[model samples]
Target: MPAQPDYTRRYTVEEYFALEEASDIRHEYYHGEIFPLDGPDGPEAKAGGTKRHNRLVQNCVVALRLALRGKGCDIFSENVRLAINEADHYNYPDVVVTCSPADRQDPRIVRYPSVIVEVLSASTEAHDRGWKFQQYQALPSLQHYVLVSQRRRLIEWYSRSDSGTWILASVRELDEAVTLSALDISLPVADLYENVETGPEEGPVLLRLPD
Candidate 1:
């Protein structure tokens, strides 16, 4: 008989961080439920094409850093923590930009971010567009949420309007340029997917994160 795998029981936000191996995998705590973070599996999972996906994310990071020079806004990749609330939920997006001074000193976690970006993979597409989007919208300082696709060169920009509504804007194809009004910067889609290879029919698509 095969031995059964032992799953770690549910843990509170405080208990989740008390362990030494907490960094190994991302965990989400929702209403006292601790769930392992997982992306899509099967075909959607394979669509990522690791090298291409990673390159896309890296290119954006470099461009963003250069654009924000001397602006007092710090940008971070997935390793940085974003505390969603006091109870439990904490997340790490592909990129987070914070202009708030308080977040500058605390290198470990950021409470206020002006903009957040996620490079979409098949496995995480739904969550990113749905549940995760809801969580991010709750942050008072989150002015913009951007979703970049791995399959094709597409960008979706969600900006908060004066009416407290998030408006959707999209840029498709490598030739199109995208402007992030929140950051006061613009870039061509080609720069985002630089050095990435894709099939003729396989191009990135950007969609609104669900409300």
Candidate 2:
């Protein structure tokens, strides 16, 4: 979903909660600022994606949920808020998986997440790969972060190592799959784009951990 800065007054955590309670739209809160995720204030409503976008997201969520069923890990997609106190933020990830007992008890905010998947669009690409991913790294329980592309059948998989470093890898070919060692499962690049339509593919992406 597209996150646009709300130029209004800064809000406390309490006030932000109140705003969310009274409003039907979903907004992300960060450091007393509210970023509306939907509505006219937001040029393209991200909380709700295009039909093509929705299909991609559903494919990811359904696959993860089916794989983790009865294993105690819960899979959630869209609208579920993840609270990052380390960053003073509350934002909704497109897909979130958690096995934390503490998260199981909480209904509103997820403080711990094992895996996070985001289907990227032009507007959200930079933010998702930059600030949002940085904030997510603050969650100690997070082991894998996946970025699904709408322009092509690709997934960028970032996994944390035992030595506490993150390694960046990706699968963009149809027959390729990325293994999530922490989850003990492999997701095919083709599987994620199943039944989904996309625009023209972007130029090839070459990524490595920044120095």
Candidate 3:
């Protein structure tokens, strides 16, 4: 196997945004290192599941779009890249809802996102719930962060209250419902996993291994 690329070089937030061609794949920059995202398999694959996870995300997006109809907010899927900070860390989330006008400048990437949703996968669950969560909190306009479980029909919502505290609200089973106050909408968990086939009821499983 070939040697992995070195990405320890530090970069300023400005320099990171100056890159002209930074698409085709996803990358995460930390401290000063840039790590290219791996292919969708293994941990990512498990999170994505066979077809259940895909439908869940899709259904959620559709519901959100309908809820925000006539509102200025635009809903985006995984293709849009989001610049988090310096070192040029850019990631593509499963769903992004942005009401900021700056989103029009670059249809392919968004700078300000009001809400970001990551479909929890075995490979990315930890970061989504931890480091990535920290980074997202830095955005002043961010009001909601959602994590959807792939193995089962569940949704965890983190909402930023008026006091700036992030409170956790959850929808445990498929029959339970969830509402995103940030977008002013509610959804049934069943819609999220319309065609999913879950195995035995497993206990709480952490999605990602520690870095």
Candidate 4:
């Protein structure tokens, strides 16, 4: 195994931006710290998406595009940076939908996002559900946060209510659809898992006893 990479160093937002400009690796910045958004550290380490993860993300973006066409909304996938708060936090969501004119004009990080989607993996599921979602709650423009499962046909949906309460919803059945009242559109659950491969079985583990 390769030695673990170091990330204890802190950085200013300017420095983070400069690093991003100079390096090919993508990092998420939060409170003067950066976190890599790639696979595990080693020669075999690849980019951050499995076959299922990438397909689901692509399906989501395509669905949103059809629903929001000619509505002045833009959908970004994988590469665009989103500002959870201006300088304190930033992340690259799997899919981001923005209808704000200000966000459409911004060349760098998007300040206003209407919806954020994250395709869950073994490595990122906890962070996506915990601290990442917590930080995303602070964004005033965020109306919905969607989490799609990679190994199963399930989606965890969070939407803000009229009284500023966050409501939890789930779409687990193929016949069911996720009703996004914020976007005024319903995304069919089947569309997301269409013709995609998933559910890799775990292999048996063998224990080495006191060798």
Q: What's the CA RMSD of model 4 in angstroms?
A: 6.1
lDDT of 3 by residue, 112-156 (tens): 999898887665676788888988898888999999887656689
Off by over 4 Å in 1: 1-8, 20-23, 38-48, 199-211
Q: Which stretches of candidate 3 lie over 4 Å from their true place?
A: 1-24, 40-50, 200-211
lDDT of 3 at 34: 49
The predicted structure with the larger lDDT, 3 or 4, is: 4
TM-score of each: 0.82, 0.87, 0.79, 0.87
lDDT string, candidate 2, 58-161, tens digits: 99987787677787998888888888773557888888999888897878778889999988876577777887789889889999999998876678989999
> In model 3, how large is the Cα lDDT of residue 166?
99
Candidate 1: count the clashes: 6
Q: What is the lDDT, from 0 to 100, of the residue 11 in candidate 1?
A: 59
Which pairs clash inside model 1? 40-123, 151-203, 151-204, 152-203, 152-204, 153-204
lDDT for every model? 0.73, 0.78, 0.71, 0.78
Alpha-carbon lDDT of model 1: 0.73
Q: Which lDDT tens digits does candidate 4 get at residues 84-182?
A: 867677778999999999986778677889999998775556667877788889889999999998766789999999998999999888899888888
